[model samples]
Target: MPTAEEIRRRIIEHGLSIRDRVIATMPQRYSLMVEQIRSIARSYRGDFDTFLTNLSSIKGLDLLVIYTALLAVLSKHKSLSDEEILKIGDSFDRHIYDVFSASKARRALEEAGVEKEIANDVISGVVKALNLINNKYNSPYLWIAEQRRIERFENSVREVLFRNEGGNRVGRGVKLFLRLFIHDTNIPLAVRIAYTQENKKYILHGDMYTALVTLRSGAFEDVASITAERVKARVAKRLLCEAKEGGARCKDVVMRLESIRGLVRYVGKISGDPIVYERGAYDIGYRYCRDLKCEACPINDVCKRYTFIKLK
Candidate 1:
């Protein structure tokens, strides 16, 4: 097997290659999405109440926030496929299209095959968050606009996003939800700021966690050495700094690591952004590193298949 350092190098190379390729020739992947996001951001300057009353279109920003709240909660369950998640989202969307009803939201989620407790958790937590947004911040858009620091802003968003109707805490998906919410190109303006300033603080999602731990084994101080999410994220960021400083491909490596860390989004894909360009080379339709389709994986020769799972 290749050494861990070699494996890390290979991962970085493949990720950057795919990123560059997509940016160069796949305008269709992000161009339209970027433009649509720009239009949405430009068209809406009103506060949350007006946004709720005047905008009932599916494409409206309020709906996006609501949908993201729903999807982010559901996304915590790794077993659900993307199609299944979308189905659940659609069901909730239909029920609470113009107005949000907690009972209806829970029922729709349960009917769409979500577990009872999880459905309840999703609805209760999201409803509380939405209510807080309306009552305190006046609007989610305004909440975003008023923030100065990224960390404080993220914390504020997380506070509302984690709200539960019964005053109980929701599960550990709050940060994941925040990441997904801010990264969505539908709010390209926010993404531009967050990604540029704080991308280093992002934790690798579960999908890329295995690949990262595998590659880092025996090479350097392992991020798995810690269990705290903040500590682990700091370690991961430090590793990125070391890799960028020690390697010839500094900028490229950091960008690729960012891609793997769930900080970059291809038009339709999530998490597996580094390999979004893979197709004929792998002969597999779509492969995320977590899929462990090593036979078709471009980095298989160096990947160690090792895994550690204490990440948040």
Candidate 2:
């Protein structure tokens, strides 16, 4: 029966505790490295944004560096279980495969004389470059191997997405992918560190809502965004319908909406644009709970919200 404020407090406490645990478990050398990396990364936030916006201009070597940096930071985690490490590896492999595949597709289109129809010049360039690299290597086997690796990675991503847990799947996925990519021996250490820091900043501040909004607005070159109004309206409708079906009081539904509104406000303060954040938060919350009360239900017992009637 935690009040809304109490639940918020708990979330903050839990987040802080988790951050501390991650920091505590890091090796001394890694801890020092992370600090240095963070300082360098702080200076490049704007540059990073620009890079994301102009991802096509990024060379294969630059991409490789980003992957390496991410892996280095992930290596500092002392508590990652064997399975977890494997999972991370799988995710990273998938991300790499995706890049490779896109590059290959672009090449095929260009070879077929259809590059102009593709519209995305960056994608076209990447594909053409990948094709050139393949030709230079004189190894179709490499492209084949990349395709197989991407398939495996995609399966892992699907499993992570569908799992029924409130745990931070996206965060975990990002962390795992970063580590493997950065640690890859083929990539340079400096590039790996640089890319890892850039990704870390995105994860630390970017929530599902922010990601969706960015996608909708088409502001980001790589990732997509969604409209704030559409997201909020959808979530509000779902919550209201759920409450109505569950025989909950109108006042309770109103309170629930209010609680969601509060979350939106908080996210806005942290992320900028309260309206977009609020809509995104509501969408996430609704989707997280689906048709049932989650473990983190703020108004469970006293609220008398139930989809199924009890047999007294």
Candidate 3:
């Protein structure tokens, strides 16, 4: 696995000609923010639990104020350009104003005898913090959108497995296999050999090999029985085709597979079939191989699965 520093160095080395420094910094920045958010969420769990319990004790407007404050602090280091900041501020303002302008929220505030001055103060504080472009470098909305997209993709995978009657054990096994394979930074030599000869893409082979090993040990006993040469040839063919056809870009294939892995896991857990899980992976791999366009994969024609692929 590449260390954070190593990843950064690699990015700098490879991205010198990419023009947009922000684009190059995206992966690192996102990693940092995710780590920070996890830390913050863990630290404030007690507060969050209490807030949820005392929901009625706080006004809706007060909750919005707190949310905006958290967003400001969390996004302080995003280093957004002036235009990006303005767009975010505008989104927040419009969203908040629309909520407040609603009949239900307005009526509730009025019934509570809330002072307009207090509401104005809260909104103004949020707006001021949002407008401070210097400290606000991140795109919280984009992060949220990405999260939603991932969730939707996972749901689609689950639906497909459930509809197909794939067995539970196979699905579960495949899901686990996928998770292990997809996010690994190091590519295994065996997987690289298989992928390059068959699929044509240079994937992180280490991850794929680990996944195969796990599959053999766990659900795919038949696969375990298969000769190593046969397995290598099969995988290589699939990967080579995908690479040549532009279904799997060497740069982003790992990330795209990670998303697909998450979907596979979700479906496996829901459907309770190991074969379903394996089939899901094969379907994804094959679909990518057949369609040059990642977005328009042939699997969609028959399998009906949807997933978000991060575009460069």
Candidate 4:
């Protein structure tokens, strides 16, 4: 079996490989979204209010605030795909302000064909998210751009995640939004990626979490079989922390996280547009781990699962 350190190296190496491949060829929906945001940013010419006004026009950004609140309550265990999440957001975009109650939102999502668990989870998350954002910033769009200090931005994200009841200050959705928002306005990739990495908390969801757990489990027995999302996230964070502390020159952790999340925005190497990897990476990773298809997995050789196969 590969040593834990070796496993860590392998994961980081594979993650970097995934990052390059995906960044080179971004997904259509995500690429389009970046383009659209950039187009608006270009038109606005650095007017904050106008940029925000047009930005909130996106359901994902607006819906995100509500969900961030929900994430505080439910935690950041995303069970939906990016497509599904965006579709649901679009459905509610027409009248999200008009419907504030869980019952109302749940019923609407159900009518729109969302599953019961998903509907319940989404509604539960947003109600508190809306309250928190409203009491503080009054609008989600403002919340994204309100804090000038990175610490303040990180704090709000933590507040949203912990349901504003107070707990460890760590968050993801807002940061993800901030990433896209800043990148759209032409923030340097190094700056944004640095912030994301410095912030220390990775943007995670179900598939990404699962893939990490599987990789970790295959290589390290200590963390193997961890199913709790929060616990799994901590383990994932620790791996990167160890790598960083060891002075490993592994590629950007944030980009690797984005690669797993199935979309990334980087200053394009050959073009003016940001490179965006399409959604489905997490799905593919999840499936490989879920089905135990270790032999055919792209990173199988680095994974301990391959070690098992070798012994057999």
User: What is the clash count for each candidate, in the order shown?
Assistant: 0, 18, 30, 6
Q: After superposition, how far is residue 32 of candidate 4 from its true place, in Å?
A: 5.1
Model 1 C-alpha lDDT per residue in residues 160-279, reported as the tens digit of each score: 775431211233355434444243232433543333444334433323343244322322222233222333464466557656775343322121333333311121122232222111
In the range 1-312, model 4's lDDT, one tens digit per residue, is: 566445444444444344322122333343454455556656663465676677667545444345334333333444444454445445544445443567766765676567688667656666666677778877765666555444565556656644544421223344343333333232211233223333232232223443343333343333333332333364456556656775253322222433322211111111122212111223335546556666766656656442111100
Off by over 4 Å in 3: 1-28, 46-211, 219-312
lDDT of each: 0.45, 0.33, 0.30, 0.43
Higher-ranked by lDDT: 1 or 4:
1
Error of 3 at 84 (Å): 26
Please give, for residues 113-204, the per-residue lDDT of candidate 3 as tens digits: 33455434434444443344223423222112122122232232223222222443323322321222111121111121112222122121
**In terms of TM-score, how similar is model 3 to the real structure?**
0.20
lDDT of 2 by residue, 1-312 (tens): 433333333333333332222233333433444454344334443364432333333234333422222332233322243344344334444445334455453443344333344413434333443455356533322221122132243333223222222234434433333222221121112232334432122122233332332222222222122433444454456557666774353322112222233333333344422222333333433333234444453323222222221111
Misplaced by over 4 Å in model 4 are 1-34, 38-104, 112-125, 147-155, 161-285, 306-312
> CA shift at 127, candidate 4, in angstroms?
3.0
TM-score of 2: 0.27
| Clash pairs, model 1 backbone | none
